[model samples]
Target: MTDASLPARFERPSALAFLGYAAAIVIILWSFTGAGFSIDKVVSSPPRFADFLDRAFPPNLEPQVLARLGWKMLETLQIALAGAVIGITLSVPVALLAARGLIAPTWINQIVRTALGFIRAVPDIAWALVFVVAVGLGPFAGMLAIAIDTIGFCGRFFADDMEAADKGSSESLTATGARKLDVVACATIPAAMPAFISTSLFATEKAVRSSTILGLVGAGGIGIELKVGFDLFDYPTAMTVILMIAVVVISIEYLSGWARTKIIGVVR
Candidate 1:
């Protein structure tokens, strides 16, 4: 209870930790300089942005334009849904292999985990570019990109969730002479299902956002429309595209959050 027995208010950082902090600060400053950070530009950006707002205020709300954008938005949703389904389906097997102490051996688990990490490290846009080359510029390419990206996103989380599942059930099943796959199907997967559902919902949301930009690389979505608008300096149309994208993305996010909460609550 004495002052000497109480923990120190602030422990001094280690020499290595201090050095790491200093190095981080230096790197940040170096990056800012390299990236041309400028207070003058920041201070003067408002008028330029205001001018852009003036040009974009009258959103191109023509009925035909709205219909076209609506169709494209629907296509974007389709891409996201199809890709999410494929990726989430594939993630199960991939995660089974990646999960330590699950179906795959430690060596196999490490390799699969490393592969998933590599997949995740590459941006979805980069994947879209690659798929565009392979599949010839369309929603198919965008779907493939979203699928790969979702697999990468969901696989890691799925593996971790499986690995963290209540081992007691698996152990009991094993004691009853159940095979590894049986134990996984009945015990491990069931235990991790809630987390899997939550993760899948997030993957869908992510796919939607990624799909929109995939069109920029000719991977197919409304991105091409946005690009064309900007290229032609059609600011009004560009603003409309931006607004449509915002609405769709926000709506999907809200729905995903609601689904996740409901499902998780039911599970709990």
Candidate 2:
């Protein structure tokens, strides 16, 4: 085609493009407000961090210490697992309600999403504090706190996944004169199963980490043990606890990966 006959392309600068860049810079600066985030501060902190790291190495691996730490870590894992299971189970109905395609009423979806957002806004530590106050300190409080937090997170993600599913399957189920519950069970649930499982696993992994923190507030787990170690200025023991958490987290990540593959079938 001749140059003169070619379609003309717009040369105008995009207003939205400039605005987006400006907004990103503003956000980056705003995020650093209280950090004293200069290059000098960054350069100075490394040596201090290195000293701390040097102190953390050559971890204490005494058999007795390992035994106690292991028990506490197991307790934390149990609390996490229980919390995740309960949370994921409860999230299903709430997620369905929040899914727009599944629920025709805009107000209902809005209400459900708003509730989930509110739950998510408060951190698990805060929930742990509240539960600890009401329940008077235990793994029970930790479990409940994690469960509540997971419900918010998993429910929101699950709803989004469900809403994004193919509409044809759902419509087909409805056309078969199936009940709403039946259609959901057959169409929506199956379609979203892989995502739901993945979300649940992610929530479980997070709950495990959060459960450890909950113990700091007297909610019961390795966190309490960690606090004790810190209070006594036993950096070796604290490091051991931290290492245990790292191992557990890594193990859970592997297991979740395996489970995901099993559920979704091997991706080509």
CA lDDT of each prediction against the hidden true structure: 0.94, 0.87
Model 2 spans with C-alpha error above 4 angstroms: 1-20, 266-268
Candidate 2 is scored at a TM of: 0.89
Model 1, span 141-176: residue lDDT tens:
999999999999999999999999999999999999
Question: For model 2, where is the 10-residue window of minimal lDDT?
Answer: 4-13
- In candidate 2, position 146 carries an lDDT of 89
Q: For each of the candidates, give the backbone clash count.
A: 0, 0
